[model samples]
Target: MEQSLYLKTAISAVRAAEKIIRRYWDDGFDVRLKADESPVTEADIEAERAIRQVIQEQFPSHGFYGEEMGSIRRDAEYSWLIDPIDGTKSFIRRTPFFSTQVALMKGNQIILGVSNAPLYGEMAWAEKGHGAFMNGHPVRVGKVTTLNNAALSLGNIKTLAQGTGWQGLGKIVSGVNRTRGYGDFCHYHMLAAGQVDLVIESDLNILDVAALSVIVEEAGGVITSLDGRQLGLEAKNVLAAATPELHELAREYLRVN
Candidate 1:
């Protein structure tokens, strides 16, 4: 199958999810807690349902691993990873930072991704070997090579603070030109569009960062776990940089004890 077809399907799925999310956003919805105590809402469920329907129509045989819904046929050669709302807490708080995330994974590799922030009116997508784009325009990461010249974004650093990498993170914070905690999809979007030079998150799920990994890499950036491993289902942290040199330098300070 061509990657363009996969990209089209992912975008269509994201659009379907956006409609459901907007409807609930305008009205009101009830929130509930899941096993992990994280919030879930009607919008999340309905959006995932809508996204899954769109993708299934395009490729019924493909598997699905969704945040709202559990995995189905997860071992299939091709699978879709869906996060109907990447920032559910933000959504519930009436913030526009939330987004619909969709990515197609062939075996262990992500082949394409689409991220849509409905209220923000921004969308980004990318495919392997093809360039990344935002709002229909091509995008790329910044060219900052040194930490002193780089702008860094941090997300979900609670776990990092409790680990051996805490000091390393402090060093990064002190050395960077500027830092912002633009947690969730917002920072990744900015990084891919060259608005930020690096992004770090010590806690996240694969569903939260899979689509983002594809976008950042396609935009001429490097993304991996804090441990310097390639992103896969098992990834728990993120250390994405605009250049390989910056990434390697950050990795040195971030090495786990």
Candidate 2:
């Protein structure tokens, strides 16, 4: 399928998931814990099922990797990544930070993405080489080139403190003009829309960031692992910035000798 079609499908899937999520938001749902001890709810399961149904109708041959459902045909040339509720904890807390994340990956490259935060009333989408959009308006990253003048956002700081890069992160934090902990989809959306200059996260899964990575890059920003590696399925940490110079500087500060 073409990139445009993939983007459309992703957007539709996100909307479908959003409906399910909102329904559970209005009504209450029971939360459960996975073996890993992360929270899960019927909203998560049902929303992911809704997303998969929408995508499956469009591309039955494509593979799927979802936060709620395990991998399906993960090795297929075309695969869809889904996170029905990217911030489940926030969702359970009645916050608007949760979002439905969907991305189409052709081989190892993400070609399209759609992130919908229904309660937040924001939807961002992008097709490879087509740039990025938030609520139908084109968006781009900020132009802050230096750390001293840039605003930074942090996520999962507790996990980051346990790593060897803690001191490095501290240096970057001290140098930045301002820092905020806007965890999960919020920071990525803010970065893509030029509201923030940088975002750093120490703990996340591919499902949490696949769609976000595409949005940031398409918006003229750079996103990679904290150590400056290319984003992949195995990526857990993130270091996204508005410009290449800012990204490199942050990477240098976060680099462990």
State every prediction's TM-score relative to the real structure: 0.98, 0.97
**Weakest 10 consecutive residues of candidate 2 by summed lDDT:** 1-10
Itemize residue pairs with steric clashes in candidate 1: none
Specify the highest-lDDT model's number: 1
In TM-score terms, candidate 2 sits at: 0.97
| lDDT for each residue of candidate 1 in 70-187, tens digit (9 for 90 to 100) | 9999999999999999999999999999899998899999988888999988999999999899999989999999999999999998999999999998999999999998988999
Using TM-score as the measure, the top candidate is 1
Q: Taking the tens digit of each residue's C-alpha lDDT, what string does model 2 give over 1-257?
A: 23476787888888888888888999899999999999999999999999999889989999999998999999999999999999999999999998999988999998888889999999998888989999998999999999999999999877779878899889998999999988889999999999999999977888899999999999999999887888889988899999999999988877843
Instruction: Candidate 2: give its CA RMSD in angstroms.
Output: 1.7
Once fitted onto the true fold, the runs of candidate 1 whose alpha carbons sit more than 4 angstroms away are 1-3
